[model samples]
Structure formats: C-alpha cells, structure tokens
Target: MSTDTGNDARQQWKAWHEERTETVSAPYGPLALTGTYWIADATEGRIPAIPGHWAVDGENGERGGAVLLTATAADGLTVDGRPLSGTVRLTADKGPAAAARADHGGRKLVVIRREGLWAVRVYDPGSAGRRAFTAIDVFEYDEDWVSPGVFRPYDSRRRVSVRNADGRERGLGLDGELAFTAAGSGFTLQVGVEVDGTLWAVFADGTSGDGSYRFRFLRTPAPGVDGRVTVDFNRALLPPCAFADHFICPCPPPGNTLPIVVPAGERRVLLG
Candidate 1:
C-alpha cells in the first residue's frame, strides 16, 4: 500500500509540474508581461506607448464605474484586435493576459481594475524577460515536506499595510494562522483568505535571496470545518515578482518569514 501511494503521489506531482511549465511559458503569462502602467503615473491621462486615455470614475468607495478607454483610427488602436473606438467598461483581469484579446499590432493591451482604480498592461512578445528565460530551476519533490496543518483564526481579522513591488503601500488582509510541524520543529504562518476562502501565504525561508528567490507563495485549499489542511512545502512556488520586476507582489510580513531553510521547492530560473 505504501508503494502504491508513493507511485500515485509521483504521478500527481508529474502532472502538476507539466501544468506549471505550460502556465509559465504561455504567451502572456508572467514572462510575457512587458509593462504594467498605473494610471496614476500618466500626467496627461495618456500611458506611454499605450493608445488610450484612461481615468477612474465612480463614487469614492463604490465598485461600479467605467474606465474611459478612448481611441480612434488615427490612434491606430484595436480592442480585441478590432479597431477600437468609444469607451469600454472594464473589470479586473481575472486570468492570464494572453487570454486577453485587446491588441494594437503585436502588443497585447490588458485592462486591469484594482480597488476601483484602472490601469493598462502592455504585453509584447519581444519582452526582455521572456527572451532571457532559459529554464526554471526547481527542486525535486520530497514527500517528507508535505504534512498536515491546522488553521487558527485570530480574535479578529487583522490588516497590515505593506509595500507592494510597484512601490505603493496597500492593505494586505489576514484571516488566520496556519500551523504545521516539519523536521521536529513546529511553525506558524499567517495567511490571507482568497475570494474562494482558500488560504494564501507569501513567505521567505532561510534560502530566500540566497539559494532561491527572495520569496515564495503557498496556497492551500479551504480548510476543513476543524481548520485542518495540507501544508505542502514541496509545492511552494515562486511569486510573479521573481519573473518580472513589474509585478506588484506583497512582501512577506515580519512573522511570515520562516527561519529554517526550505530546500524542497522551486528556486530561481536560469536567465540567459
């Protein structure tokens, strides 16, 4: 039975690795993100090389409003590859940018809304990061790194204001704690609940910025009624900031940084 379970785990890991390779290599995945231009950076409401005048509109705190993306034939712009004109109400990009159809020539223009603020991302196949990516250096899977964990909620949810990769300070909401033991050492990690209620942890182990990338993310499915879940260090993943400087990923908070070296997951990619 043990042999059979090991074989099944190996097969599952293989499938997951295959899927990850495809995801990162996709046309507009992290490697394809050439630029993220926040509307706040544009003085004349024109983003550099992006053909549109974008602005945020709505009541101060409400979520419903339109992002004015005005263009013309003279502007030589296209929405979903068709000549763009007038305004398009855009919500956040909930998926990969390649799947976003807006284009102007070879560039893929993605509309993104965050916290009711509007922005545009330009993806060019000629992005230097994509050209430089040689291979993702990852550690071989080790079953020992996978263990059961428990989630404990704080007396009340806590929010921390942290600096984003884009040099902006924003609130990162926390829901509870995830506690697990490995190598006879118990550790606790603070985590945020996603819209689907799953827990997400952005963390840095001892290997961070040394043997591996500075930070990694671990996501576990929603915990059981008892707050039990799997703590799978073997599946720890490098954040998008590892692949592109433009990604506005949040840094690990004070307590989220682990003291032990985690040598069981992804490290840096080979850049050419």
Candidate 2:
C-alpha cells in the first residue's frame, strides 16, 4: 500500500478509537454492566433484581431453547416501556445493553448465551465504573511499529485451561502462532483462529503493569496463501479487563510475553 493509504488507515483507526471510547462510556455500555446472573442459579425460577422467572428449555429435544421470562406488573416489570403481563421468548442480546429494548423500570436486562449456558446481565446508568471513567489513555500510534508477520498453524488445534478474570477456569482454544519482530527482538504469540481464519493474540510486554495496562490484544487479518500477515502494533488494544473487572478475559500464556516494551498503541483508560 502507498504511504497515503497507510495514513488513511491510521486516521480511520483513530476515529474508531474515539467512537469506542464514547460507546464504552455511554449510559449503558459494558461499564454499566452491574451483574451477570446465570439462569442455572434460579432454581426456583426467580432472579433477584430481574423481572420474571427464567427456566432452561430445549435440553429435552425442544427447538431453540428459550428463557421463559414471565413478566407481570405485580412483579414490577415493564417491557418496552409498557406494563408487561405475559411471557417473552428471549434469545441473546443483539445490541448494546442500553439499547436492549427489554427493560424493568429504569434497568436494562440483557439476555446472553455461552456454550449452551444462559445468563442475564443487568445494566444500570448508575454503575460505579461509568461514574469513575475519566478518559481512555492510549500511546500515540507509531507507524514504524507496524510490520509484516507470519502465521504457523499447529498440526492440530489445542485447548488450554486458563483462569479467567472472574476466577473461573475455562478452556481457551488455540489454533496457531503469530511470529513477528519489534525493536530488533523477535517474538511469537499463541493465537486463536477466528471463523474467517484470521489470527488473534492477547499479549503483554515490559511496559505492562507500569507505563501501560498489563495486557492488550492484537488481531491480524487472514493470512495469505504463504501465511504472511500484517502485524500492526499501532492498533494494539487494551482488553476489556482493563476497564471492567467483571469481564473474563484470559491472560497471555507463556512465551507470549515480550521482553521489550511496546511503546505504541493503547495503554489504559484514565479513571478518576
């Protein structure tokens, strides 16, 4: 690509970052996610602070299992701003929590599913994280840090058990390694293959925990037939774990940590 093309990409990325910051700090973004209640815990079919009873279906060979949310005015519930008194088949949230379109008074209820597990996230504008967010501090983009790299897939895919930020153990799927070099030092990161066959990495560097956030993510587009890819450190991003403690982001595995400091890309969000 020409220098002008690279500059255009950089400018577009800057706009994306600004938009993301605004979205996260919005009234009902991730920062406003106050609670995630698993439906399994609601044995009696009632979730606290959430309207209606939730029960799992489809395990018995039913079509598209649904979380039966029985709403009633007596339960202090209102769906779409109108007093609700019937059941609503809820699937996964298709948009932001604030725009979920399912509400109980001033609260927004979000339905989610993960590996067959069902849960509901409650988002309120009064969340502590939203109130504390001051700014998103990021390292100035350095075009020199962006370079070409290669992806090497393993003979077979592998799953590694890692502790999530929520203190739960979950399996992290890995597909290959992304090899790159920066500041005269070579590095390889374990990456997961996206559905489109691209590679992604969660990594930390010497600057982590001090000059910047502990860890960030890098995503390379789908590799060419020769496995060549563009490794853009200028687009390195701080994980959601940097902003919200409730997120279950995985830590970078061994060897993925670079010895040299990556002085480009996002650092941390300035909070009060």
Candidate 3:
C-alpha cells in the first residue's frame, strides 16, 4: 500500500472506532441491558424488576420451549406500540433488542432463551451503564496486521459447550475455521457462519489480560465462492459484555485463542 493510502486507512479506522463508541453508548445498546430473568426461578411468573407475568409454555423446558406473557394496562407496557393487556405468546427474539416483544415507554423487554432455559431481558434507555460509558481504547492501525485467510468448513456443523461471561455453560455452534498468517505466525479461528453468509469469530490473543481486554470479536464479510477472506486485525472489537455486565457474551471456544500478541484493535473500556 502507498503511504497516502495507508494514511487514509488509518484515518478510516479512527473514524470507525469513534463511531463504535457512539453506538455502544446509544440508548438501546448493550449498556442499556439491566436484567435477564429466567423462567425456571421466576416462580410467580414475575421477575423482581420487570413488570408483567412470564411463564413457559412447556414445564419440561425443552430445547424449543416458548414462554407465555401476560400484561395489563396497569402494568405500563406496550406491544408494537399500543397498551398491552391480556396474554400473548413470546418466543426468543431473533432480531436486535430494539425490536423486542414488549416496550415499556423508554425501555424494551426482550425475551430470549439459551440452552433450553427461557429468560426475559430488560433494556432501559436510562440504564446506569449507558450513562457511565465514555469511550473504548484502541491501538493504532497497522497495515502488517491484515492478512489473507481461508475458511475451511466442516462436513457438518458442530456444537460445543463453553462457559459464558455470565458464569453459565451454553452451547456454541461452529461451522468452520479461518486459517491465516499474521505477524509472521500462522493462526486459526473457529467461526460461526451467519445466515447472511458473513462470519463471526470470538477470539483472544497474548494481549488478553496483559494490556488489552481479555477477549475480542472479529466479523468478516462473506467469503467468495472459493472461501477466501481478508482477516483484518485492525477491526477487532470488544464484546458486548465489555460494555455491560448484564449481557451474556460467550467466551472464546477452545483453539480460538491465538498464541501471538495482537497489539492492534480495541484494548479497553474508558468509562466516565
């Protein structure tokens, strides 16, 4: 890359980093999550802080079990916009938190299930984490950190149990690995193939627990038909748990942690 082009890339990275800070501090980002109530322990069909009744449809808690939610006008919740009253079936929210099933004025009530466990998460615009969020510290972009990679898919998808940041064990699905050479060393990261053909990788490096966040995530655009991709360390990002404790970001699966020190990308959170 030419000097001028390299300078432009660095500026673009700075702009991207700045935009990320704004997104995380936004009203509905991860910092806005205040609670996640599982159905098993919500005996009376109620969470301590959330308003409304939430009960699972199947007492057996099967993998595909759903929840039944009942709210009243007095509960101060809305569905799609209008006042909510009466019972409604709620499945795990497949979209973003912004599109959660229940809306409570400035907050969103999101229903989610993990490992056959049903739960409801609350995202409040006025959450303390969002209020305290200031910025994310990042390393300057270096051209040498970017490398070409190949995605090798497995014959079939595989599911592995890993510990989440919430201290719970959950199933993480992997379809392939991205093998690349960076900083003069070879590395491979197990990734999940997104529905849209993109790729998601959760990984850690030597920098973890030394000078950077314990782990970070990297997302790549869909590879071509040949399974070739550009692994850009310059775009490494901190997980949602780095911004909010209420989130359940998954830890890096075995073999996803690299052996070299990755000195680029997001390093830490700067809370105000």
Candidate 4:
C-alpha cells in the first residue's frame, strides 16, 4: 500500500511537470517576453522599438494609474479586436499576455503596474529564448521532500524591501510564516498570502546558484482552518526570471533562505 501511494504521487508530479512545461513554452509565456518599458522613461511619450506613444493619465502615474496611448492604423496596433487609429486609455492588463487589451500582430503589449509604477511588456512569439528552449530540468519526484506544515499569520501584514532580479529594490509583503520539518530538521519560511489564501514563498537553498536556479518559488495550498498545510518541495518552481531576463522577480527575503541542500525540484532551464 505504501509503495502504491508513492507511485501515485510520482505520477501526479510527472503530470504536473508536463503541464508546466507546456505552459511555459506556450506562445505568450515568460520566454516570449523581450522587454519591459516603464512609462516614466519614455522620452516624448515614445518607447524605443515599441509602436504607439504612451504616457501616464494620472498624476505622476501613481497607484490606480492608466496609460494614454496614441497610435495610427499604419502602426498595426489593435485594441479589443479593432484597429486603433487614435488615442486610447488603457489600464493595466489583468490577465495573461495573450489576453491583454492591445496587440501588434502576434505580439502582446501588456500594461502592468508595480508599486505605483506603470510599465509595458512585449511578448513576442518569435522570441529567441522560446525558439531555443527545450525543457526545464527537474529532479525526480521524492516523497521524502514533502512535509506537513503549519501556517502562522501575523497580527498585521508587513512589507520588506528586497532586491529584484533587475537589481532594483521592491516591497515584498509578508502575511505570515510556514513552519515545517523535513529530515528531522525544522524550518520556517516567511510567506505571503495570495488573494485566494494560498501561500507564496521565495527561497534559496544550499544548492542554489550551484546546482539549481539561484532562487525558486514555492506555492502551497491554502491552509485549513487549523492552519494545517503541506510543504511539497517536489513542486518547487523556477521563477519567471530564470526563463527571461525581463522578469523582475523578487529575491528571497531575509531569513527565508534555507541552510539545507534541496535537490528534489526544478533545477534550471534547459535550452538548445
């Protein structure tokens, strides 16, 4: 019975890994992201190499900001499946790049807001990285890496300044910590609560930057009423930044780095 259970878990992991590969290699995935242009840096409302003139529609483009875009039909820009021949106001896209409000042929122009800053991301299906990608390197599934954990919510949310892959510091909000034990060693990870109550963590292990990606993200199911959850390191994921340099994935926060060597999850990006 125990052996059967382990086999089932392995099969599930395999299926999940396969789905992840397909998602990341899709036409509009992270590998397709070629650039992230902040509106503040646009000179005279022009972003180099990007069609359309873009500007902020709000004061200094603070929170709740929108973008003012001006384009001609000749630029081949489209919004809502119609050719955009004049100016339009666009809010940050709330969905995947493929579903963004604006497009230039097969390219997606997604507007995003981070900490009151507005930026536009271009996801081109013909990106070089996507074309050269093969697969994501992952370790064999090991049930030993899974552990029951407990979530401890803080009295109030807290934010910490952490450096991102782009070498810029950003605010990382923390809602609580996840406590768990594996291999008889106890560990705790500061985590953020997702909108749906799932736990998100950015962490690095002893193997980071050596055998695996510099850092990986872990997402655990929502905690039960009793704060019970499972920490499944087998599902540890390579951050978007690992697949594309344009991603500004945040670095691991203080005390979130584990001292152990975790070799049971995604290791790196495999490209040919």
Candidate 5:
C-alpha cells in the first residue's frame, strides 16, 4: 500500500512538471523577454526595439517618477486600442504582460518600477531565447526527497535585501519560516505566504552549480494549524532567470543553503 501511494504521488508530480515546462515555453513566457531598458539610460528618449519617444514624466527625462510616452501615428503605438499620439502619462504597469500600458506591432511594452527606478520591459514573441527553448532537465522522481514540515508565522512580515540574478540587489519579504527534515538533517527556510495560501521558498543545495542549477524554488500548500505541510523537493522549479537573462529573479536568502547534495527536482536548463 505504501509503495502504491508513493508511485501515485510520483506520477502526479511528473504531470505537474510537464505542465510547468509547457508554461515556460509559452509565447509570452520569460524566454520571450527581449530587453529591459531603463528610462535614465536612454538620453535620446528612445528605447531599443520599442517604437516611441519614451521620456520621463519629470525634469529633462530624469526618472523622477513615472514615464511620459510620446507616440505618433507613424510610431503605431496604442493604448486600449486607441492610436497613441502626442504625450500620455503612464504609471508603471502593475498588471500582467497582456495588460501593459502600451504596445505596438503585437509586442508588449511593460513598464516596471524597481528600487525607485523606472524601466520598460519589452516582451517580443520572436525573442531568440524563446525560439531556441527546448526543455527543462529534471532529476528522476524520488519519493525519499519528500517530507512533512512545520510552518511558524511571525506577528509581522519582514523584508531582506538579497542579490538578484541580474547582479542587482532587491528586497525579498518573508512571512515566516518552514522547518523540515531531509536526508537525516533538519533545515529551516524563510518563506513568503502567497494569497492562495501557499508558501514559496528559494533555496540552494550542495548540488548547486555542480549537478544542478545554482538555485531552485519550491511552492507548497500553506501549513495547517498544527504547522503540518508537505515539502516535496521533487517539485523544485527553476527561476525565471534560468529561462532568460533579462529577468531579475531574487537569489536565495541567508541560511537557505543546504550542506547536503539534493539530487532531486529540476536541475538545469537543457537545450535541445
């Protein structure tokens, strides 16, 4: 009976991993990101590959706050299906790529603000990374890597500054910590609580940079009142940065590294 249960769980995980792979290789996925152009970097008010005069909303193109895009009919830029002409005040695009403030020629111009600096991220379906994407390499299913864990929430959320994959530092917030045991060793990971009552963890094992990618992500259902939750290393995921270089994925926080090699989950980016 135990063997049958483990086999069923392994089969379910394989299906989930396969779905994640398809999502990553989607048309507008991370691999489709072409450029991340900061407004301060463009003195001429022109972003590479984007058709428009994208100037700053304040002071000689200085990135004081928002962005002011001046798109003429010739530029063929649009907002809400209306021809964008003259100048329009556009705050950062807080929504998804399909809901970007501006777009042209079927490409999305996503505006984002980070570290008080504003930038425009262009998502082009014809990106080289997307075109060259093949598959994600994952370790074979191993039930031994799955374990039950405990979650402890804090009275308030705390933020940590961590270096991102782009070599820039950013803030990563945590709601609590998850305590679990694997490979005969106990470990704890600071986790963020998602709205859907799931926990997200970014961690690195001894296999990092050797047999697997440098870091991996895991998401599991929120712990119960008794702090009971399942920690399945077999569902480990590659951050968006693993699929494209333009993404700014946060790195692992302090004490999240495991000394033992975790030979499970998605290991590396495998191109075919």
Candidate 6:
C-alpha cells in the first residue's frame, strides 16, 4: 500500500483504540461490573452485597423467566427516576446498564438471563476494578494484520458445549465459519451470527496467555452479498472477562485457536 494510505489507516486505528479505551472505562462498562448474583442463591430476596430483595417468578428455578424485586424507601432503589418501595417485575435488560430500570445510588442493577437462569449484574461506577484500571495494552496497528476473508454459512445453526470463564459449561451457538489467510497461512474460525448479520469470534493465538490475554474476541461487520469481509486483527478485543471476573465470556471452541502468533490487537488490561 502507498504511504498515504497506510498513514490514514494507522490514524483511524489510533482513533478506534482511543474509543475502545473510553468505552471500557465508562461508568457501566466491563471494568465497572462488580458482581453477577444468581437469583437462585438469594435468601429471602437478599443477594449478598447487593441491596434489596430479589427473586424469580414464572419458571420458578428452571426455564426462562422474569425477575421479581422488592424494595423499600430505605433501600434507596430507584426505577425510572422514581424511588421504588414495592415489588416490581423485570425482564432481562435489553439496553445499556445505565438505562436499566433499577438503580441504587450510582449503581445499575441489570437483570440478565442466560441458559434459562436469571441473575442480576451490578455495575457500580465506584467499582474497584474500574478505579484501578489504567489502560488496555495493545500492539501498534500493522497493515499486514488485515486480510480478506470469506464467510461460509452452515446448513443450520449449531450449538456446542463450551466452557465459560466462570468455570461452568454452556451452549455456544454458531452459525458460520470465517476463513482467511494471515501471515502466509490459511486459518478458519467458527463464528456466531448476530441478528444484524455481523459475526463474532472467540479465538486464541500463539500469544494468548503469554504475551496477550488468555483469549480475545473479534467482530466483523456484515459480510457482502458475496460473503466477503475484512478480517482485521489489529482490532481484536480483550473479552469482557478479562476486565471483570463476573463476566462469563466463553472460551474458544475447538479449532478456533490459531497456531500462528497474532502479534496485533489488544493484549491485556493494565491496572494500577
């Protein structure tokens, strides 16, 4: 590539990296997450450390369901800007944590569901993880890390049992494979398809657990009609679990681990 073109690409990469830094350090970002308490573990509506009474309705202890939260004026919980003093039913929060229906002081009580299990994720602006975070270590951008790839859709969606960062196994749904050539060798990764046709891959390379985080995530925009995409390793991301232990990011499925050293992309969280 020409010098001007490479310079422009590097500038864009710098901006993207800055934006990523801002995102992770935001009030409700991964670093701000303090706890993920399962409703099944609540005793009489009390979850350890988190204020208020939490319970699950509709499916009892199994299957998909809604969350029931009970609070009083003294609990200092607010719903939609109004102080809540009664029982309220809440479904999984679909938006940013700051927009969740429940809040206590500067903390967001985000209700989430996974594999038919209900839990409340607490995002506190004052979380120690957030306060200690300095920056995310990343390799400088390199054009050689960008490559053309193809998406091959599966005959049907498939779910594979994979272990999560939380030490539990869960089903990871995959809809396609993204194959590309990097560093003169071909590689293929199983990817999950988003509703918008974008792709997500959880992968590891020769640098994982050594020079980089144990695993990383890659997101590619929707492929073209011809199933083409730009697999940019410079933008590889540290999974949420890398910033906060409460996150249950899944491990890369079999074969997603690349044998080559991927020297570009975010590596690890730098904490003070």
Q: In candidate 3, which residue ranges exceed 4 Å CA deviation?
A: 59-65
Candidates' C-alpha lDDT: 0.80, 0.81, 0.87, 0.94, 0.87, 0.93
From the highest TM-score down, the ranking of the candidates is 4, 6, 3, 5, 1, 2
Q: Model 6, 90-183: lDDT tens per residue?
A: 8999998888999999799999999888899999999999999999999989999999999999999999999999999999999999999999
Residue pairs with backbone atoms closer than 3 Å in model 5 (clashes): none
Best by lDDT: 4
RMSD from true fold, candidate 6 = 1.0
Segments of candidate 1 deviating more than 4 angstroms: 59-64
Off by over 4 Å in 6: none
Clashing pairs in 1: none
Model 3, 1-272: lDDT tens digits are 89998898888888988888888887888889898777788868878887888788875753447888788899998877778899877788888888886888768889888778788888999998878877788887899988889999999999989889999888899999999999887888999999999899999999997789889999887999999998888899999888878778899999999988999999988888
lDDT of 6 at 69: 82
Residue 270's lDDT within candidate 2 is 85
TM-score of each: 0.90, 0.84, 0.94, 0.98, 0.92, 0.98
Task: Supply candidate 6's per-residue lDDT for 181.
Answer: 95
Q: What is the C-alpha RMSD of each candidate to the true structure, in Å?
A: 2.4, 3.2, 1.6, 1.0, 2.2, 1.0
Model 2 whole-model lDDT (C-alpha atoms): 0.81
User: In model 5, which range of ten residues has the least summed lDDT?
Assistant: 56-65
TM-score of 4: 0.98
